[model samples]
Target: MSKKGDFEAVRKDIAELMHQPEYDDGSAGPVLVRLAWHSAGTFDAETDTGGSNGAGMRYEAEGGDPANAGLQHARVFLEPVKDKHSWITYADLWTLAGVVAIKEMGGPTIAWKGGRTDYVDDSKLPPRGRLPDGAKGADHLRWIFYRMGFNDQEIVALSGAHNLGRCHSDRSGFEGAWVNNPTQFSNQYFRLLLSLQWRKKTLKSGIEQFVNFDEDSETELMMLPTDIALTQDKSFRKYVELYARDKERFFEDFSRVFAKLVELGIQRDADGNITNTDNEKGGYHA
Candidate 1:
C-alpha cells in the first residue's frame, strides 16, 4: 500500500495499468479518459448537484444509465490499483487516472488536484440523462454542456478527447473511431473534422452517424452527430478550426478547460483542500 497521501504512487500504478494489450486499441487509456469524463460531466451548475465528489456510479441508479455503458471496463481496470492503495477515493482515482492516461498517451498535461470523497449523498446525486447524447446536434450540445458551465470554446476543446476512443456498437449504439491512431492524442480529430467529407451512414442497429473512408488506411472513420455539430455551428467551428491548425493552442486550452471540468462543483480552501465534502462514514462500494 502507498503511504497516506502518496498520490504519486497512485499515479504510477495507473500508468502501469495503461498497458492493456487485450483491451480496446491495446490500451486502457481511452476508456479511462471516458470514465473520468462521465464521472464528472454530470455536474449541473445551477443546482450545484452532480460532479466528481460522490463516486455515485458504483450504485445502480447512476451506473445503470444507458449513457454510461462500457465504462465498467475502466472501473475494473482500476480496481487492482484501488486494492493496492485502499486509501484513495474512487472519485479521486477516476479523475486522476484520466489525467495520467492523457499524459501517457502523449496528450497535454492536465492539472488535477485530489480530495474528492466516496460519500454518496442521495439528495445531491444527479438524475439520469445528464450526459450528452451522441445522436444529438448543436442545440442539444449547448443545453448539456452549458448546464455544466462550459462555453463554446471549452466545449470544442473537450470534444478533442474523441481522438482517443472508439464507440462500441453494443454499448453506445455507435461504431468506429474518430481518428486512425485512436491511442495517441493530437489535433487529428479536429483536422479530420474540417478536412474530410463525412457522409451520413445508418448502422444496422438503426443508429445514425457520419463517416469518412480513408483511402490510405483503408479504414472508415466516424463522427457522432454532436461532433459534426461543432463544425456546423459558427461559434463552435471557429475554435475547431483554430485547434486544427494550432496544436499547441489546443493543448493549452484543453489543459485549462479539462482542469476546470474535473474541478466543477468542488469548493476548496486556501490550502487546496476540498471543503464541500461528506466526511461521515457509510457510502456505497466503489
Candidate 2:
C-alpha cells in the first residue's frame, strides 16, 4: 500500500484501470464518472445532508437505490486501487476516480480536493429518489438540480457528460449511447442534441426515450426526456446552444460545475480543510 496522502499515485492507478475490455464500451471511465456524480448528487442544500463526505453508497441504503443500479461495476473496478492504497478513503477515491477518468478520457481537467471522509453519518444519509429521473421533463430537472444548488447553465453543462456513456436497458430501463464515440469526451452530446431530429420511441421494456439514427455510424443515438427538455425550455436552451457552439466554453463551465457538485455539503476552512467531515474514521483533519 502506498503512503498516506499520495493521491497522485491513486490517480495513476485509476487511469490505468480505465481500459476494461469486458465492461461497457470497453472502458470503466463512464461508469466511474456516474459513480462520482451519484455519490455527490445526493446533496440537499437545505438540510446540509448527503454529498460526497460520507461514502453511504457502500451500504444498501444508497447502493440499492434504483438510481444507483449498475454502479457496482465502478466500485469493483476501483477496489484494486483502493486495496493498493489502503490509506485512501472510499469517499476520496470514488470522487478522485471520476476526476482522473474524465481527464484520461480527454475531458477537461477538474479541480478536486481529497479530505472527504468514509465515516457514514447516519443522520446525513440521503434518502432514495434524490437522484434525477431520466424519464422526467424540464420541471423535474429544475426541481432535482435546484435542490443541489445548481443553476440552468450548470445543469446543461453537467449533461455534457453524456458524451462518454450509454444507458443500459437492464439498469436504467433506457438503452443506447448519447454520442457516437461513447468513450471520448467532447461537446458531441450538445451538438447531437441540437442537430438530430430525435423521435420518441418506446422500448420493449415500456420505457420511452428519444432516438436519432446516425447514417455515418449506422447506429442509433439516444436522449433522455430530461435531455430533450433542455431544448424545450428557453432558459436551459441558451446554455445548450452555447455549449454546442463553443467546446472550450463547455469544458470550462463543466469543470467548474462538476467541482462545485462534488464539494456540495462540504464546509471547508480557509486553508481548505474540510470542517464538516467526521474525523474519527477514514477522515482527514488539517
Candidate 3:
C-alpha cells in the first residue's frame, strides 16, 4: 500500500511536466492519457488475463508492439517521477499520471486508486491486438470493447477520448486531431460528431479516414472510421447527441467509466490478493 501523500507528490510532478518547453507544446498531457488507457485497456474480462498492474509496457516485448506506437514518449517523460519516488510501481505512476493529465488539461477529475505492483518479465504480456483499431467501424468497436467488459454506452463515452491528441503518421499510420483543442478535453468531440459533415479521404500513406467537409469548420479536424461509427450506429448516435447537448453528463460519465476502466482486473481475487500476479501483464498502448 502507498502513503496517501505520494499522490499529492505525483500530482505536483505531473503538473510540472505538462508544460515543458522541451516537450510537445510542453504538454505530454494527452499522450499520458493514452498511456493510462492502453495500460488498462488490456484487461480481458473472461480470462482475467491482463490489466494495469504490471506496467509491463516498459519491456521491449510489450513496448515494441505496434499498438503502442508513439506512447514511448509518455513512458520516457514519466521516468523522472520514478526517479523521485522509487517506491511507487510503474503501474501506479502511469495511471496516476493520467489522472493528473486529465484534470490539468481541463477535463473532469478522474477517480484513482493505486496498489499495483510491477512484474519481473514479459512472460505474461497480454496477447497483441487487444486495443481498438481506428480504421474499423462500429462492429469492430463493439468487438474490441466488449472483450474489455464495456457496454455500448461506455464504448461511446470511451471513444470520446478521441477528442484529445492526434493520430501520428509514424504511429497509427493515421493523421490529424479529432478536435481543434487537442490538449483540452471537452464535449467538442461529441459536438463535432453531431454538426460536422465529413468526407472520406485516403491519405498518402494509403490510410482511409474522414475530415470535416465544411470550409468554415475550424481545425479541419479529422476522424477515424470508428469515430464516425458513433453517429452512424443508431444506439451510439443517441449518446453522441446526449453528450453534445450536455457537457456535464459527458464529463460525469467519462470520469466514472474511466475510473472503472483503469481498475479492471485489479479489485480482488479468491485469496484476498489483488489481481497482479507475478506472471503479471499490464500498461497502456498508444
Candidate 4:
C-alpha cells in the first residue's frame, strides 16, 4: 500500500477507537476545541509561527500560557489515540478533534485538512499574548486577530465558538459561558446577542464590565466587551446579521476561516495534503 493508503487506514482505526467508552468523559470535546484555539492563537504574523499545526504546547513554556490553564487534560486525553495512530501528528489530532466536536455537537460541518508534523524540540515554541483576553474591547480584538491576518468578518464568525463553551473563572477569570446550552452548538449566540438589551455591570479588577442582556427570563447572556463590540460596530454587525439570517452562510464561512486559522504557523509537506479522517465514527465514546 502507498503512504496515503496507510494513513487512511490508520484514520479509520482511530475513528473506530473514538467510539469506545474509554475515550468518552464528556469534557474532552469542548476542551479539545479550546486546546486547538489556544494552540493556534499563539501565532504572531511578525515573528512566531506557533499555530495549531505544530502541537507546540507540549513544551513546558508554551503550555504555561495563562489562557491555556486547562489544556493539559486535552493533551493527556489524546495520548492513546496518538500512540495508536502514530502516523498523524498531535497538532493534526487536536485540531481534528475540534472539528469533530463542533459537528458532533450539532453545529456547522467544518471542512478539515491536516498536514501537521511533530516538533523535535522546545526551541520552536511561540511567544505569548496571542489569545484574546475576555476583558478586552474592539481595539484589543482587532490587534490580536488582525496580527494573525483575520479581518472583522472573520473575527465575528470565529466568535461563534463562544456558543460552545463557558468562560471558566479559574481558566480565564471570566465568569459564565456565552450561551445557556454551552455543550450544544447552535445559532443561539447570535439570537441572544441581537434580542437582548444589555446593561453594564461594575467589576472589581477587570478592565471590562459584565453585561446583563436579559436577566429576568434567564434569556440574558453575558458578553465580554469584545463580544459586544461585534454588534456595536457597523461593519462587524453586518457580518453578525448575515450569520443570524443564514445559518448555511455562517457554516460555510466558518468552515473556510476556521480551517485557515488551524492551518496557520506550520510548514506543510510537498504534497500540501490535509487529512480529515482522524475519526469518522459518529457520536461520543460513551
Candidate 5:
C-alpha cells in the first residue's frame, strides 16, 4: 500500500525470482560473482573512486574492460529483475546477486547493502588495470589488490572466489576450471592445493602453467600461477592452511571480506537503507 511496503514487496518478488531454475544453474551464479568481481575490482584508493558501490560498469568504458569480457550474460540475466524492480539499480543488483549466489551455493552469508546507482554514461567507467591478472605471481597479486586497500589476509580470503568460477579461454585467455566441481562450493580448492603434487607444464608462454602430479591427467581444471603461488608462498600458505583446516573459517572470512570488497563506495542511512549519496570511498559494514 505505502511506498515502503511496495519496495518490500518488490524485494520479495526479486528474491523469489532469484530461485527460478534459469538463475539456479551454477553458471549464472559464478558469472554473477565474476560480474561483481569486475565491477568492484576497479577500486583505486589514490583516486578515491571506482568500485561496486557505484555500479558504474553499466556504462561502456567500464563495461568494456577486458577483464569483464563475457559479462553481458550476467547483465542479460538480471534484466527482468531490473525492469520489474526499477528502484534497485544495476550496481546493487549485480553485487547482491553475488551475495545470494554465494549463500545459495553452500557458501557463507555475505553481508549486503543496496545504495549503488546506475549510470548510463560511459565516462564513469574506471580505467583499466584494476582487475588482477591471472598470469601474475605473488608480487603482482600484492601490488594489484593492495592498491585497492586489501591486506594479505583479505587478498587470500577474496581469492577464495576462485572457489566459485572458472577461467574461460575466451574471457581470461586461460582455459580451465579451478575445481573439479565448479558448480559446487567447497574447500576442495584448498584441499587439492595441499594434497596434489604440482609440476610445471612443458608448454610455457609468458603466462604460468602447472599440471597436477597425479597421473598427468588431461582434465581441463587448471590453476593460475597466483593460485598455485598461494601454496608455495609461506605467508599466503598460512591462511590457506587455516582455511583448509577449518572450512568454517574460509566461509566466514570470505563472507566478510567479499562484503567489504563489493561495498567499497556506497553509503547507508541509520535504518541501513543505502542512501542516494555520491560518497564512494568507505568500507562496508562487517
Candidate 6:
C-alpha cells in the first residue's frame, strides 16, 4: 500500500495529463473513463477471470479487442505518469485516472482506494466479447453488466457517464457527442433522451444510430440503441428519469458505482498480494 500522500501526487500527475494539446478534444478525460470501464467491465462473478487489476489490456489479446479500438490513446497517454510513479501498479493508475477525469471534468470526485498489482504477460486476458455491445438492447445490457456483478440501478448510474463524451466514428463506427457540452459533465444526456425527437439513419460508416432530428439544421448529438433502451424499457427508465431530473443525484450515484467499479474483482491475500477477488455478490465492493 502507498503512503498517505502518494495518491495526492498521483492525482496531480493525472491532472497534468488531462490537458494535452495533442489529444482529441484537448481532454483525455473521457477516453480514460472508457479505458477504466473496459478494463473493469470484463469481470465475471462466476469465473473471476478479469477486471482492472491485471492491466492485461497492455497485451495484444485484450488490447487488440475491437471494442478497445481507441483506448490505446488513453493507455499510452499515461506513460509519463507510470514513469514517474513506478511504485503504483498499472491497474491502480488506470482506474485512478478515471476517477481524476470525472472530477476534473467538473463531475463528481469519486472515492478511490489503491493497491492493485499488474500482471506480467498476456496469459490473464479475459475472453473477447465480454464488454458490452453498443448496438444492443436492454437484455444485452443486463447480460453484459450483470456478469460484472452490477444490478440494474447501478447499470443506469454508470450509464450516466455517457453525459461526458461522444462516440467516435473510427472507434465505435458511431458518431457525435451525447450533449452539446460533451466535455462537461451534466444531466443533459437523460434530459435529451426524454426531450428530443430522434430519427434513425444509416450513416456512411455503415452503422445504424439515432440522431436528434431538426429539419432546419444538422444534429450533432446522438444516442446509441443501448442508450435508447433505458427510455424504452419501463424498469430502466425510472432511474433514467431520476438522473435526468436531478444532476446531483446522478453525480452521487455515479460516484458510488464508479468507486465500486474501479475496485471490482480486487482482493488481497494474507501477505498483502493482489489476487482474483472473491466472486460472491457484493464481495469486492464491500
Give lDDT tens digits, candidate 2, residues 1-286.
Answer: 8778888899999999999998878999999999999999999999988898888999998999999999999999999998999888898999999999999999999999988888998999999999999999999999999999999899999999999989998899999999989999999999999999999999998999999999999999999999999999999999999999999999999999999988999888898888876687667653
Off by over 4 Å in 5: 1-26, 120-125, 202-207, 213-218, 273-276, 279-286
How well does candidate 5 score on lDDT at residue 271? 78
Decoy 3 TM-score against native: 0.90
**lDDT on C-alpha atoms for all candidate structures:** 0.93, 0.92, 0.83, 0.69, 0.72, 0.83
Question: What would the per-residue lDDT of candidate 5 be over residues 9-57, giving only the tens digit for each residue?
Answer: 5445444544445543445778877888778888777775688766767
Q: Distance from true position, residue 124, model 2, in Å?
A: 0.5
Name the lDDT value of residue 14 in candidate 5: 41
Model 6 poorest ten-residue lDDT run: 277-286
Query: 134, model 5: CA deviation in Å?
Result: 0.7
**For every candidate structure, what is the RMSD over all alpha carbons to the true structure, in angstroms?**
2.1, 0.8, 3.9, 6.4, 4.4, 4.5
Native-vs-model 2 lDDT? Answer: 0.92
Pitting candidate 1 against candidate 2, the one with the higher TM-score is 2
Q: Which residue segments of model 3 deviate by more than 4 Å?
A: 1-5, 120-124, 213-218, 269-286
Ranking by TM-score: 2, 1, 3, 6, 5, 4
Tell me the TM-score of model 6: 0.90
lDDT of 6 at 38: 89
Better of 1 and 4 by lDDT: 1
Question: Candidate 3, residues 173-277: lDDT per residue as tens digits?
Answer: 988888877889899999998887889999998999999844655556898999998999999999999999999999999999999988887865654355455
Output the lDDT of residue 241, model 4: 88
Indicate the TM-score of model 4: 0.81
For model 6, the superposed segments whose C-alpha errors exceed 4 Å read 1-5, 120-124, 213-219, 268-286
Structural similarity to truth (TM-score) of each candidate: 0.98, 0.98, 0.90, 0.81, 0.84, 0.90
Clashes of each: 0, 0, 4, 3, 0, 0
In model 4, what are the clashing residue pairs, if there are any?
114-274, 114-275, 166-177
